[model samples]
Target chain A: MAKYAGYQSSINKAVFIYSPEQLDYKFSDTHPFNQKRLELTIDLLTSINALNPSNIVKPRNTTEEELLLGHDIRYINAVKMAGHGKLTEKQGEPFGIGTEDTPIFPNMHEASAKIVGATLTACDYVMQGLSEHALNLGGGLHHGFKGRASGFCIYNDSTVAIKYMQKKYNARVLYIDTDAHHGDGVQWSFYDEPNVCTVSIHETGRYLFPGTGTITERGSGKGYGTSFNFPIDAFTEDESFLEVYTTALREITDHFKPDVILSQNGADAHYLDPLTHLYGTMNIYKEIPKLAHELAHKYCDGKWVAVGGGGYDIWRVVPRAWSFIWMEMTDQALPTGNLPKAWLDKWQKESPVTLIPTWTDPENLYDPIPRKTEITEKNQQILEKALLPIRSKNSELI
Target chain B: MLIEEIMKTKIFTLKSDNTIKDALRIMRANKIRHLPIVNDENNLVGLLTERDLKNALPSPLVKKTVENIYEQNLEKLMITNPIVCHPLDFVEETALIFYENRIGCLPVVSGGKLVGIVTTNDLLYTYIEITGATRPSSQIEIRVNDQAGTLHDVTKVFTKHHASILSVLVYPDSQHEEKRILSIRVKVMNPLPIIDDLRKEGFDVLWPNMPGINRL
Candidate 1:
């Protein structure tokens, strides 16, 4: 917990963008992409006395025009029709609705639009100088595409928010996705735009979903060298994961010199998560936000908007991991020792698996990854290749 | 996919009597390495490559007068009757030809004339597309016995999940002689359900294979 020291004094102001309606962005009870994680995380922050009602802001419903910023009108219409039970399976197939990952539910368009608007609200708060930072635990649907949906995402909130910031505030955005899967939607949306830079560090596509995040996927046209990806090997531990993340973020921030920072905090890299195969523990969660907090203040005047993405282990992983983001955003001292008894008692009854009773993961979370040395070396090579252009530029300057 | 689907119809070509300087100018302007030579009837006669032009040029260290080097006709340097392909040929077969012959480009001939050209670059792009890396999807690899109907048995799980299969490639397992690996790219982000179904069907899935840990 001492690692979070010195981040408090630099904070100017922070706000939390949330609303009960955001929970409407649910696919089903059995779906892994559950919104219950949001409620649980908010409760954990509340129980710890880190988040106050006054610091919370209600999110607005995104207008069709705003949704059109990153989505096709036809696709939006199809989503609306599917929500109202008017579109058939065949009709919704092309739009990525009526699928197992992103099935149609009641008012799907409105629910998805609200999530998009929540991220936009976070961005507006930070961009308009109302707050130095904002957190939207309901957003970060990074896999939603311009014409269709993939993964469990319907409307891409991060992409829409970036486009909004570019048009309204005319600010250059640097998007950092620390998810297990590749941030393909947001990366492709800004692939050709010079002002918006996207960096995603995830499990390699060799076995991961949405397989496109390789070291060679830099960028195209004017945006060449703007996009960066660091796909580490599966079963990568905390040290190797954080090494690539921290080094790449520092170099990319300095090279791009963005006006603001947008981070997609997907907590599925934990060992408890059932979706992906990254062997990360709770240590990476603490370090992930610490770097973002320090770099945002140093580079973008503390203008940062944080959003949630994919995390399947709702009870044990998502709540603790997401609360750390809000705590880091508001410059609060990190929590240590045991979890709050009241919070644990309430969630333990509902959680099928026994809840972890500490702020940090226990030792020996998983068997020692057998190929730790080889995985670490391969990740280092990837990091070097990704940062080659910027390193060369720095050498030339010297 | 057919060869015509990936071949480039907008070609940079030269005539039989064209000077070496003309070939050099076309290559440089277009940033191309190969050029097809044609006759008066617009029929394929020969092929000129940058390698051929490099061999024909005089050495830079030579002080002797060599103005005639650039004026030499390309017919003297071009390879007559180079390997050519037809438009209807399968792209996979064309790839085999490229691999076996160790060539970079193939001129597509139809009706006794050159219609298009397929370079190594185009074939590589086709491979990328076939793997579905250009789209957003997850890849799953399954190890199964090299017996009959293994593919049919494995694909049933994907059909149960209604997950669209973007690409399916069957390759021999190097370590095991009797086992084969089915590399499938499906158009979905969450592949857990399908992976579970595969495991339940007694198929060994080698997803994210940890080097020393043998989970299978």
Candidate 2:
């Protein structure tokens, strides 16, 4: 159990889940799924005096039993063996290990379990009422499957943490993924369970990897009408991104009425992110968490657990975008003007690309997208299609 | 792949003497569209489809209800001597039959006995599997000259990166007659290294391409 520094009667007592070991979830020095963003994000928050030790909590290691809630025992054994160099490449192939995306690293199982434990810790804090909200920058490996690793994710921390909440606290979880890629692993985990609803708003999978989050992928069996997806066009700007995000999130929360909200905050949708093509600015990052914070209080009794995900532009986009999530969680006023001079001075020399100087992005971040109107109109159609079930049900009631 | 491997062996069937009402009840209960009409010796005699049943029934807007329509024998409406496929036939050959006949399903016959059935849905799913969209993977397209050993040259890059190839499809380039587009889906998320190697080797890689964008 994490040591809490007594209780203050503050309305927004948010816990930031962190540990130096969380940085151990590294694939390679040059790999795009870098954890150095976590360090940079924490340093930025520290420099602004927005986060301190009392508000920071160290993550625990996830146990084998808890891991079994989401992963198969055979896959877990394979991961363990691969971490120790006992498993051969052929042996690891079926389990999606030793591949280019998730290469075998020393003690990988421990590292991945620690990230899962971090997300579970955040869930415990929020669900147990130790905090109104919690943020685990190490978690949100949303592409990890039950028996396979994918998209640079080894073990899906979000899915395990949601299952932990379901078993330990009996809480109905509403998972919201804002990653540039589809949150397929977490969505499929509870595809037939009515108690867990997943909503992912991402770039369309027409040309992207892991291409499946269509509007037609509503949940199955008893969980029908519980899954929602909004695949926006490639060049979607911040205004259009947030329009679908806010509308779908608000209506879904109203319909599901979940006991807690677990959000995966992947900051890679920015224009600077190399992997995806969405034109999201820092504005969407600021608004993404604000709505979750408000709705957690409204529908979930202020219970919210957040985790970090795919943000490849670690130097330029990730740190600032993630820091905004923490600031929102703590109910701090959104920062404005130039970034902390000390933080920028420390990171600029190390960053290859020039960092954005202001808390807000510069005007006209890229050449104006040629088909902005058509993209927005298409996204609006997708939003309607995704919400059709709930809309029809509400009309039937009326 | 053979039709026996992909066909659904456990199928619903009806005898020719069974009433149309029996076929309708079985179709509704099983939620199946096609039924093979078999004789006493379990030989496929005819095929009954949901479309035939619907055409035999009275329309929803009709004021006069026809009482004798449900009591009619299925043999009167069934497609006698319908085109049937052999279980030993290649799946590709079976698919061609579907397209050429403009039919939705084909019952698999083995030794003059009804054994299995395959529908257009099954064939479409087989296409999806062959395209490798069911797995977690990334797709890469390369334009190569329509010559031998182009596939060998291109796949060498994936082998270098230790990436497994899930599926490879070859199609003629619409713009260039001598060029062919090789769409390869590999079971890995980050294809940057492979893409880099292909570019370094002077291969034209159209990775996640969009319209109105230059291939640079």
Scored by lDDT, the top model is 1
Root-mean-square deviation of each candidate, in angstroms?
3.7, 2.6
- Model 1 fnat? 0.84
Q: Write the per-residue lDDT of candidate 2 for residues A92-114, one digit (tens) a residue.
A: 88888888788899999999999
Residue-wise C-alpha lDDT for candidate 1, range A1-398, written one tens digit per residue? 11235664433478899999999998899999999999999999999899878778898778899999999999999999999999997789998889988898999999999999999999988898878998998999999999998899999999999999999999999999999999999999999899999999999988788888998988999999999999998888999999999999999999999999999999999988897888898899999999999999999999999999999999999999998999888779889889999999999999999999999999988778778899899999999999999999999999
- lDDT per residue for candidate 2 within B16-80, as digits (tens), equals 99998999999999989999999988899999999988998999899898898889899889999
Clashing pairs in 2: none
A230 Cα displacement, candidate 2 (Å): 3.1
Runs of candidate 2 exceeding 4 Å displacement = A1-7, A10-12, A88-90, B214-216
Q: Which pairs clash in the backbone of model 1? A: A210-B137
